[model samples]
Target: MIELNQVSAIQQQTQVFNQVSLKIGYNERVAILGPNGAGKSTLLKLINREIYPVERAGSYLKLFGNETVNLWALRSKIGFVSQDMQEDYTPYTSALDVVTSGFFGSMGTHAHLQPSDDQVALARTLMKQLCMDIDEQRMFQRLSTGQKRRLLLARARVHHPQALILDEPTSGLDMGASLGLLSLMRNFCGEGRAMIITTHHIDEIIPEIDRVILINQGQLIDDGPKNEILTSEKLSDLYQTSLQVSQNDGWYRCWHG
Candidate 1:
């Protein structure tokens, strides 16, 4: 449900994307794979409307068939979860409060922002569905990293958005936590929702994600089905290092050749 035509973006005096063109459709599962500092985050920001592509000939961005949309309305259609958002919330905010803040499109609850009863109930229901079993009143900062991530996932889905955009969905977690989170994501996508995830790790490309887009150094490297794009040669070139790729039970992994 996103279209970028020869789009280029600049952030902090650095050109993050150059003539990037791509389309993500509704109910599609795709992964934007790249290394660090590879413009992955910048691309996500552009989709989230947190940044804008530079004006140029034959370059445009469209979300849900429109060039312009209200940010509030957009959030209702696409839920975004990122590590930056996790860090943006106040440390003392309660776990449940963090989830309810999604109604206000905020990082955390403010004194003046009052969520209605139904909104709060939805947030709680989402958390339960995600299998987050922590006390609702616990401080966000006190929760484990996986717990915090799950809370953010709940917050993102509180509005029952049609799509989810996740950046480094499992950045800092042990194997168990990573798998748990990915399983939760797969369940979410099973509900006829689209998911666009940006990740460096090959294992993060869940089996449901059929399309894979590779980006490196602010340029599109490759785009195709996961079976074709995630080969050893392409992944090695994408990371600028020798890598041997293997797949098992619909999961892929890479290691030094």
Candidate 2:
């Protein structure tokens, strides 16, 4: 389980979130929604330990029911896929090498400890599962934006972490690519894994999502089951705009006047 008790985060002298509290139990798939500048990305950074909360604010961030688990040890168990994948790719690395690099937490390009043949096979399998057919030997820098995002996410899962954190995983994807990514995410939800995805759009919410967390202006606005928190009235109130929300099959759509 992941728990945040009265947690606050500050970066560059700016308060990102204030006194936010949330709990995510095992096997829960959560979608985080908010308007622009709501600190959604910052919150994901907090979970990944990219930044720490201010000590004077009496904030606490805990993972897996423990107060003091070694963060490095904990990191190996969490898969993080962020929107910022432009900086890590190299012009010369092959696709297979890129995926293999994820086994040791490298950014899909850098040289690290060699992964085993079984790991290589798994990487290829994941690529096939995602409907991607790029040459395994193709240069990393040559793939399209959508391909990069999918490859990066597949890299994160090479270790099969206990939890997954995805920040705007489909931000730049087209319709086909987005569906492929969402399908892959749904396949990850099971009896023992946990996932927290930060996204602002309705289409990004997977059908397997069990909960929703809403934030605005760096404060947690709502946190509850997806069925209860994603209503038209609640979302309109949260975004401070008149919006129509509808459910089709198991997904949601937002209609604007």
Candidate 3:
């Protein structure tokens, strides 16, 4: 679903990601895990075309099949969500309006933008599929974090994307909210779309993700099956600290000694 060939990205005179050669197929579920400053977010931006890679001979970034896909077209195929996206939302925007904005890939529905009957129907259907139970007219800021997250997911998938990319899907949530988010993520996964989530918590790499990619200091460090890449020593090295990895019911998490 994604191909990066010797890709390097620099922003504001600082190199955030470099030489990240990787290929992910259309159906494989994957996670990109690294500590803060590991260039995980930069990589996602590159894939999502929110940022550009450094120009160099033989450097390329392609989604699905072609490098020429328009950003709008690219977005329709891949749904992206992140903490910053949540913060960018208009506090007074209603849940339905938020989802409606997804039709145009805008931050939130604005006065200039109007939703058609079909668009409203699809948005409501998506909200239902994601199990969003909030009153459609409730303002985004008034909703709980978990509810907001679900609304964002509904917004992201309003166009029915072929893949989903999440950055820190469970950040700023308690155990209950985190699990609730996970359950929604699993439902999204059940729709048979490719999923790539970048996270600091091992438990966020839900069972649906079969592959894991490790990044650090703006470089792609490791790429392989989740089980092989998520070992105690590897987790320790990835975080730059000594740690022990634990697993229960196919979920993984780590703790420092």
* Each model's backbone clash number: 1, 0, 2
| TM-score, one value per model | 0.97, 0.91, 0.96
Question: CA lDDT, every prediction?
Answer: 0.92, 0.81, 0.87
lDDT of each residue in 84-187, candidate 3, tens digit only: 89988889999999899988888877778999999999998988877775699999999888888888888888778899899999988788889988988888
Indicate the residue-level lDDT of 41 in model 2: 89
Worst 10 residues of 3 by lDDT: 125-134
Better of 1 and 2 by lDDT: 1
Best by lDDT: 1
lDDT of 2 by residue, 76-162 (tens): 788888876445566577878877777776664554477788998999987877666678897778888778877777777777788
Q: Which regions of candidate 3 deviate over 4 angstroms?
A: none
lDDT-wise, the better of 1 and 3 is 1
CA error at residue 43 for candidate 3, angstroms: 0.5
Rank order by lDDT, top first?
1, 3, 2
Question: Where does candidate 1 stray beyond 4 Å?
Answer: none
By TM-score, is 2 or 3 better?
3
Residue-wise C-alpha lDDT for candidate 1, range 90-182, written one tens digit per residue: 889999999999999988788899999999888889888888856999999999888999999998898889999999999987788899999
Please tell me which predicted candidate would have the highest TM-score against the true structure.
1
